[model samples]
Target chain A: MTPVAPLMLLLLRVTSPCDTGTRVVLVPFERLALPSADARELEEATRRAVAAMPDACLESREDTLARLRGSGDALAACGDAECRSAQASALGASKLVRGVALGVGGKRSVALTVTDARGTEARAQFEAPATAPGEADARAKKALEQVWSPRTTARATREPQGSRMLPKVLWGAGGAALLAGVGFGLASRSTESKLSKNGGECATAGESFAACFSSQLRKGRNQARTSNVLLGVGALLGAGGAVSFIWELP
Target chain B: MPLPLRRTLTLGVLLLASSAASAGPAQVHYALIVASNTGTEKSQAPLNYADDDGARYYELFAPRSREVVLLSVLDAETQALHPGLAAKTRPPTRPAMEAALTRLNARMAEDRVKGDVPVLTFVFVGHGKRGAAGEGAVSLLDGPLTRTDLYARVIAPSKASFLQLIVDACDSYFFVHSRGALPVGPAYAEAVKGLLSDRALARYPQVGVVLSTSSERESHEWSAIRSGVFSHLVRSALSGAGDVNGDGKVDYAELRAFVAAASQGIDDVRGQPDVFIQPPAQDRAFALTDLKDVSSLGYLLVPTGLSGRLWVEDARGIRLVELHKERERPLVVSLPVGKGYYLRSRGREATFSITRASEVVEAGGLPWHDVSVASRGAAQDAMRDKLFSVPFGPRFYQGYMASLGIPQPVDEAEADAALVP
Candidate 1:
């Protein structure tokens, strides 16, 4: 009885979820002018990285490609998240990893996307020198490490309040202030013109020139002051509004 | 003449006429392209690439069009670069433009009499200014072609089924639509509103407009590319890279999206060009260029497995069809088949030639050669590096279409067929 029990326990341990791990199929990396050897090396580095993860298992590239071919879907065709997820399900794996290796403009960039059967996706990108395949290999592994972790759930729950509307309101208020300033400036100019034209006539009536035009002068000065203040405020507000609007742009 | 012979001849002539009538009416395309380096005012600096841009457009459209009238005074450099094209163009004066329009309209009228469909495309690439009265005007050799003049001469006199107007210049928005009070911030929103409310343009439902600058912003030219930024993009779009859905036709929306994506990576706001594109009011799906109709141009196919920022340069070093390709989608760019061209991506380039019309060269099969790196100043690098940095593929197309609140114009089966393994 003791021997049978121990043997059954050993079998149970072999079949445990922790032992078998999660099956992940890594699709071949889509290459753009990348040397075949470098692309494969980068892919292998990524595989080693994923294998190093706890409770993670990787399917071979040959097996994955065979399944994809048999299913009549090429690796390049599975570009969207949904397609990748479907491929993952079809392969009887819980996760799929895909990537693209680009060699252009004397620079090399690798981007990886990991999608699970539940349609959750994570992406990572890294750039390395085209001459250094080793650097690219290291970066590819680092990128895999980044995407393998669970995404943070602490995203901001609500959009910034009045981020857009505030700019519009500021602009509107500034525009109104500018219009009012223009009205006041025009009034002041008109008063000055009238006073200049009639000042001689007022002086001829036997009063001092300053005394004769005091009221008109006071009105013009007050209007000019108000216009200046309003114009300054309007200009400030307009500038603030422009800065805020540009800052809020996505 | 014998009675039997006369009767037979009469019957044959009647049958021939009936067959000709039964055959569908021919669809003729006409283009009038005007480029001016000099402005009407002395303060306006002479542009370096306006004539070159016009000549490139002529090269693109001449083979496909039934008749293309080019109005430009090509400089020595431009003429040397594009051999024999200078002889085909007239001086870019108002009177020459008017005469060309008259002739095109007469031909269109004749086509109409013969029950044919005629399409007119008018292109202007040069300096433009906003007047004190907030009116927009483009420079010509004789004088400015104001918004009113455009409405009266180009739109009103056209008898075509569609009239496509492409203006690449500063303040082109005001050239196409009148502006009211100047806005404090960016004037894009105001310009669009003005365009929609313009009564003159509203009257001509067949008229479509594509302008370089949507506001008072200056349209910039890149000496590296040797063309106005917006004009180059437009020419590339018309050449077939802008056929987003692989529909073999480029529409207004596609062209707009293409230009936006191509220029989105520019970090400097001053360097960025805001484009305004509106299709004919009567037909939202009016195509600017039909690839099927352009049989004289050759195509280069960018198949799957190749991706990244790529450009095609002709033998004269004129960069055409700059785009960021994606691995999943295949793209086709049309070009003149007479010259050899190079397809370049970053450090690698491949040369190919199209010897005949309607030729499609498979770019993936070409032998690529490694290019040596050249050191450039940061400013030049910034300007050159940002072009086509954003990927133009299905994802961008889907997002753009979603933003526009319009259905994606792709046939799933056809799109799948367009993809190459």
Candidate 2:
């Protein structure tokens, strides 16, 4: 064999095992006195829906039953979420799907529950006329799709690039303004210290000392005012940025 | 056994005994809540609801605390409004406060001697200002209680394992930390360094602080709630609504997030109050209130599937807790069990009752009915419509924690494990 052929073969072998997406097992739907055929149809529809998920691989009913039999778990007895989750973990599956199918009045109703290994569950219900098994299948598929839809898609659509970047821009501006305010504040403090060190020498000394002191006082006042203004603006901007950033988070 | 092995076991037992001794006895909470409407200067406008706020705080903490002291001079109007509360209060003067502090210190010392750890909660709700030298002080009936006076009198002589200081006033940030030329947020480490450098509070490593406004802005009182807005929110938070993670404890970070989320929808910039919170440097998880210690309050469960901004109003029209909820995570807010409360949304309200302590009233089970618009003034309506409009849930809490770089107080794995049940 060529060198490239062996490399490609090795790559394929490495990735084939990892390509088996999240393992999902659909347990038989419990029938509340409903016809077994109808219950089987609803279960088949749900299996199709679960298999249709892009990142999910549905375990075959035969394989799931064999695994349960091997584990000494009766297929009809595993009803609650806890039991289903345990069964799914035993079968090396990450997700478990189960439901109850009942005939209410003239309508066939099904309530499905999907439980992951972490025990986070999502539930949905669908109802259709008892005579129309095809309608019931469609409704079950729709309900299963609704229940299995990922929540992250909604969150991803809530934030856009421009809105996400605005907070960062505001934060940058706020930091710059705060730095400038600190500089001015330090200068003002230095001027005040120098004035204090003079110790009223301007009052007893010549006109030069008095003029110098007055100029220093005016400069310090201006610097302090500017610093306060900048600091206030920076604080407002920073707070606005923080609030906006948090508000934009999905 | 050999002699060496026997000595090692004896040493280990002695070490365990000493550690247990250092842990001390069960902590008993003591509260000194002070409120003053009048300021040090005559020109300052008299507030109408400071005394009411103080009374509300006293009612909330008295049932849970070993002892609670209310320092306020209730006028005829306030006394008539809050009947029998005046008897429990003293004048909000310096001498009165000093004498109260002396008595409390003595009682705390006695408790320590009796092998009980004492925790002192100091709450001040009133007017405050910055002096010419940039020192912050809260006004009392006699005069301003300066920062130096507070450190020397309150922090220095306190015989408590932990001291919690809650202040709601103008420019209250400087009351705890000195303002330098460059203004910066008081992170826990920086605040600890400042406290240590001052040497005034050097011995107190278990001091926590919560302030209303971080800057020189004045915190406004809303007539809609008949109390100072910040104080009202703080009261709600401490009453157990601030326990965001359902951990039965309200930490400083949770309190800050609660206040921020509750006030995020205020339309006017001036009406929004900035919250400053710092837990003790030694313990970031230091809870401001433990719900298990409280007996007078019952919890209202806003369970999964009820989503939006909602507020609970008493029969007397006192709006207590306002929160925005998400559909996934559930929340439980503690309210006084004696009164009937209405959970109000924008156009609907559902009445609920908690007839016994620790009763959990499910809001989702209540029947919601349409509510007609009441003809209040424009300002009141504006304030009512704008508050607590933003939803607070896992998303907001995650964003807040990430932005502040605060470590998650609850382990994700543990939370998930707990959720499974």
Candidate 3:
């Protein structure tokens, strides 16, 4: 039997704008029969995610290419008719919403070369079945970095409004950080509860550290005090991160 | 019944023709049946019994409103009474049942379906359960077949010299399990070949047999309209529907198909009947042709010249012996010892046997002796093959076209190879 080639990258882009400037989206398309079948499901998933973007102007070539390339809206042709039409089509908004979303679910086995026709540049291939949610975003970010790298003088002709990083990237990152913080806080709280319950018992149970700490000597009390302070500090940090995300919401 | 009779007669004729055209009349076939039912259960009141080949198969059922009937046509085209057997529709009594069984055994011992015939068949039908000693157990009757009594009376006495037994029972194979783990597929076929080995059959070779289980041991719910497990299988196998091979007759090999098809209603448990031939005391009578009506009279010299043959021939175009002339004379022929011979005669009926008399020939010089009168069809078949041609060339082939004696064209080759000087 032939071993399958490992995935190098996976790009998952979403355009939902319900609470924040950008949504930290998921691109779980690894449960299909094969790559081709996966692509079909992925396309549907992407369309649904994009159409759900709240308050975001839909565009075709402009927004999609910009998001994929990570170009800011300031660089896009704001009043150009051709650019507007292209962008609208890319975002799948000019016509009535098809209401149907393309769904993709399968493992991508090999590296696929996706090229931008207008830019005449070969984009990096992202291996699917990404290791984790962050891994997929990391790959997408890397691909964008490659496209807009300072070393590369040439850029794609069409730039859309939705993909402009000034608002979207900041918002997406802020939300992801907020979720991560809340997750950490919840985890810490649970751990603290467990620790408190065991604190007194541990000393009586003859556990060396707990016994020594439970003696209530000035030194041991100081050590416990320090640990509590650290936990409090961590909680504070988590709250601050959550507030920053709320501040970034559009 | 009429159709079956016509078919039987036609088959008789065809067999005679094929034998005469093929090799000698020595085609070894057999039937082995194991019946174990005393009809003691209330639901299984009456037991129906028939002796085929040398084995007695019992079909047991409840007899209440009506009398049970047993209609049988033996291999010789003769109607015989089933002495000690009781049908479900008949009254139940040990004495009556024993008497019937005794009479059947007596008849079988008294007469024999002699000669080298093309094929032998045995069929039995009776009420049976799915498994042994379990809820929803399988049985031929509501009760059980006593193994000891069966072995002593039915099995030992009437074992067909060369015939195959076609059995239809739900848990019929429960006994084989007592014997050990059966090899996959059909154990019956292997057992048959093993039992009737050329060496064994040469010494014996009575008849070939096949049995089919209508229902499995775990299944086979009692059915008022449908026959018992054994009867169901027998009927289906004979209907040509179960004929896996294109051969006109459903031989032992086709039995698996019957068993498989019948297994649907018969739970997961499967049963295969036993088949093998018994050693004959003398060379089996093989009917080369069927001389019907006046022909039979003429062939047997029954004061009617309409049918039958004066003599049977061997491979060398040599007349083996005059048949149907008067008495049952043993026509002996000289053959290499330890080899098999195909016996054929005017009737399509035939069997095979080994030469124990140091030579292939009977006590007399010829290879065959005839005791029964022949029909017209039987005579034609005999004339085709029995009229021998040359020493060793293709006389057998010519005889094959005519369809007369045994020693088929193929067998001649085998015989020549097996011949010991």
List the DockQ of the predictions in order: 0.02, 0.01, 0.00
Model 2: share of true interface contacts reproduced: 0.00
Model 2 lDDT, residue A12, Cα:
34
Candidate 1: residue B288 lDDT (0-100): 94
The better-scoring model by DockQ among 1 and 3 is 1
Ordered list by DockQ, greatest first: 1, 2, 3
Best by TM-score: 1
Tell me the TM-score of chain B in each candidate: 0.90, 0.86, 0.36
lDDT of 2 at B372: 90
Per-residue lDDT tens digits of candidate 1, residues B113-194? 9788799999999989888887889999989999989888888878898899999998788898766554634556434654
Query: Best DockQ goes to which candidate?
Result: 1
Runs of candidate 1 exceeding 4 Å displacement: A1-74, A77-250, B1-26, B181-185, B189-191, B194-198, B214-219, B373-376, B406-421
**Pairs in clash, predicted candidate 1:** A105-B346
lDDT of 2 at B46: 85
Q: In terms of docking quality, how is candidate 3 classified?
A: incorrect
Against the true structure, candidate 2 has what lDDT?
Answer: 0.69
List, residue by residue over B20-131, the lDDT tens digit for candidate 3.
5545443422222233333335655433332231112221110000111232222221113222332222322234344544554444433344454322333333444433
